[model samples]
Target: MGLSSRSVFGLVVSVGLAGAVGAQVTLPPPAPRPEMPEYVPPSQRVDEEEPAFDPSSVEFDPIWTLDEDGKVVGPDGLAEIAALRHNPLITEDLFPIIETILEDRAKEMDTKVFVYPRKAIDALTGAIDNFDVRKEDTRNVMGEIANSLNVSEGLVSWLRDQGLITEEMSMVSFNIMQDYTKRTMDQIAASMPDADQLDLISHQSRFLVRLGLQEPLSAFGRLSRKVLELHPDVVENAAELLELKGRDFLDEVAKALKPLDDDQLKALFKEAYESLHGPVVNSADTDEKIEGKPVGDR
Candidate 1:
């Protein structure tokens, strides 16, 4: 007949206990662990060959890209140039070519010096009326002049700031200032009713110029005297200039000169003069004279 529910449950539990205790079971050897394909070196691999490199498929960027005007366009070119600074060996072979280009550029720039006086006068005419020379703002005015002339104010002030006037001043600034100062003095002379007499006084007495060339420390004193002489009703005292915080353009230039010894000053002056005016001309030989008598007479 049919088994009772309690008897069936006991029979199932007994079977599970027997299996848990000692039943030896096989898992059919894990499906034989399918064999992996034999290892192949990339060189010997035929099915997975790397695609051949195609020159046509590759894209290239130009080292230099130029605009319509032939000027380099993007920072890409500049970056290429800047990268050369670190790898100096790459540039060692390029220096001669670079120097030749620089020499050509310098020659081109040097020719611009001749037009400085006219350009300076034009700039002063437009801007001079608002400039007050009595104040410390004179330096700012000079800076404006420097900007108009494309002469860097930083370059001009470098010697003064570094106290290294023995090196050199910016030639462009020097030439511009020389002409500008002359024009300024001319304007001052012209404002007077006795302009001709004032001009004569200035022309005859180059004492200020000589004093400045001799001792740059005394240069500002010369400027003060010239200003006072030209504008007696305008300026109070030479010492009033000292109130401009002990510094102005002229004061800076004078101070810059103070660091240089006489020999250095002479050398610097000679170099500057030569740069503006070609080499100095040697004097023609003169025959020796005896006792204030001409050599022919003797």
Candidate 2:
């Protein structure tokens, strides 16, 4: 007697319901959590034994060997002998042994100055031997010269580009730039109200040198005269400005002149004059008033 399909299905559903009801039933409380172990910090731990400082010893070959004449013959020995002969401190041998030690000590302390290493000398000689007057090489030489003279390489390059200088004329270009800078500085010093103010003149010269101004100093001299004509008190004004602004005023002036074309530069000079003099009432106005008064009609 096999069970029917419907009876089997009913038996499975009843089993599933029993399992669900069992799962819904409340369980007893969980057991208390186990206690955690205390922490042991690394600093509190015991240290391991340290190893001893013994290093493997090595034997070196002797630098000098005795000759039949009982003379030290190696390179180092020969060098030491040469040093002994040259040393002025070993004048008269007081005690032979002490003199030897003193000579060795002096040789050890005698630092060689102004000496180029053999490899360095060789390299420099090689470079000189291989030197060529190519465009790039010429530019490099010009740049170095310009740097030494405290002028700008760009100025030199510009001069070359303008055909004022050629590759063969690099040194000539440098001399010209140097002369220009000196002449410009001298002109500026002369144009100053107090040419004897060396410190002030030096400051101005350094400023110009840093700017590497390409224009002739006569242009600047003319500009200075124009400034004075517009405002006779410009020197006093400059002193006040310097006191208030320190180097900033000079820096700003340099910046303004840096990119100016010739026309723009001339306009700038005129504008500076007009700006200073524009606000002042004419002396003719006061004169006119006095003249109209009819010589103090009493």
lDDT (Cα, tens digit) per residue for candidate 2, span 1-298: 9989999999999998899898997668999999996787989976778854321121223333457855433322222232233323333442364344444222211110001111112222232223333435633543342232221224335334545334433333344334434545555565676645655455454434333421212123224344344554534444333342323443333333344355544344544434533432342353233232221120
Q: What's the CA RMSD for each of the models?
A: 29.0, 33.0
- Provide the TM-score for each candidate, comma-separated: 0.19, 0.19
Per-model lDDT: 0.37, 0.37
Pairs in steric clash, model 1: none
Give me the displacement of residue 290 in model 2, in angstroms. 49
Query: Candidate 1 local accuracy as lDDT?
Result: 0.37
lDDT of 1 by residue, 196-233 (tens): 66444544233223222221112223333333334444
Query: Mind sharing the TM-score for model 2?
Result: 0.19
lDDT of 2: 0.37
